[model samples]
Target: MSNSKLYKGSLTTIILKLLNEHDKMYGYEITQKVKELTKGELKITEGALYPALHKLEAEGLLDVEVAKVDNRLRKYYKLTETGTKETVNKLEELAEYIKTMQALVNPKLA
Candidate 1:
């Protein structure tokens, strides 16, 4: 998320997709999950993550549920009705983007 443009625009889509698969997720959990999935190649920094989450929440694409867990209130996020549909659209768009990049980078592979 630092300087790679590919990872920049896809942060929200990634969050949405993860929420689409899971019931809900807290901030650190999301970051750790991304790291585990990517095998440490990609990292979601706090500086980038919170603002994006706030933006999505502001946009009505996400719902928050706060609960006390082990003496700490964890704010979990999940997709809204609109976010569910938006996740599908964003996934399709990302898939198309990957396809296009493949075609451009390696004509034979695409």
Candidate 2:
């Protein structure tokens, strides 16, 4: 599902889930990690990513840390306490969504 609209709604949840697993990550790193995890099936663009990050930060769901790396400053994002709690909620919601989708997509199997 490369650049599929279906995944767009879950982007924030995906970001939260990744941060929950990794502790912290920079923007580019997040993009690359997603691609790696999905085996190139998904590619998250800068346009989609930054806005989501900014929104999450504004909502107090994330903390930002800046460190100089090889003469360049890199901003890393990590979940705040609220964010950690939110990750659980988001994941549960995703699971419910997946179940609903599965039931709809394959009635017999569900």
Candidate 3:
């Protein structure tokens, strides 16, 4: 699948889960973390990532903190209380989705 297609439905959950694990993260950090976690199977681009981050912040699921890091202002994202709860639900949902897809793709083996 195209990287965009691969991440299509799961980007938000990935972001939320990463933030939940790390407590806080910046854009590049998020991108790199996904790459590391997926062993480069998934790549999050700045184009896809910034818009989603902005939307999540607008939706109140994330809180942004600005700090000067290495002489540049970086925006860090952390889960709000609502985001934490939402992450749990999203993870459960994603787990079910993976199971369903696996069954479809490998029913005989399963």
Candidate 4:
């Protein structure tokens, strides 16, 4: 989560947004993609990532598929129908949050 506590709250939203962009992704791939996207500024730990993924799966927002690759079973996650819709809603909410924070942090000069 880098050096900021801010990323913790948005972890689930981040996962959903990534899943929304790609068809499906495994755990490691997701982590690498995040690091790549953030240019190593943000790092998602396994401890944090797995729980969020489980929670999303439990909530019926995500579906998982297990496949054997190189004698190891890997779980791939993809958004459910509800998840796809939720992604859009979550993104909108995040956008609004950013806008509010920007207003507070960089208020217009009067």
Top-scoring candidate (lDDT): 2
Q: Please give the TM-score that candidate 2 achieves against the real structure.
A: 0.97
lDDT: the better of candidates 1 and 4: 1
Q: After superposition on all CA atoms, what RMSD does each candidate show versus the true structure?
A: 1.3, 0.9, 1.5, 1.7
lDDT of 2 by residue, 23-92 (tens): 9999999999999999989988889999999999999999999999999999999999999999999999
In candidate 4, the residue pairs with backbone N, CA or C atoms under 3 Å apart (3 or more residues apart, or in different chains) clash, namely none
Query: What value of lDDT does candidate 2 attain over all alpha carbons?
Result: 0.96
- Candidate 4 regions off by >4 Å? none
Off by over 4 Å in 3: 1-3
Q: After superposition, how far is residue 45 of candidate 4 from its true place, in Å?
A: 1.1
Q: Could you tell me every candidate's TM-score relative to the true structure?
A: 0.95, 0.97, 0.92, 0.94
**What C-alpha lDDT values do all the predictions have?**
0.94, 0.96, 0.91, 0.93
Instruction: Tell me the tens digit of each residue's lDDT in model 3 across 1-110.
Output: 26478568899999999999999999999999988887887888789899999999999999999999897899899999999999999999999998988899999855
State the lDDT of candidate 1 residue by residue for 1-110, as single tens digits.
35657699999999999999998999999999999998888898889999999999999999999999999899999999999999999999999999999999999998
Candidate 3's TM-score: 0.92
Weakest 10 consecutive residues of candidate 1 by summed lDDT: 1-10
Error of 2 at 47 (Å): 0.4
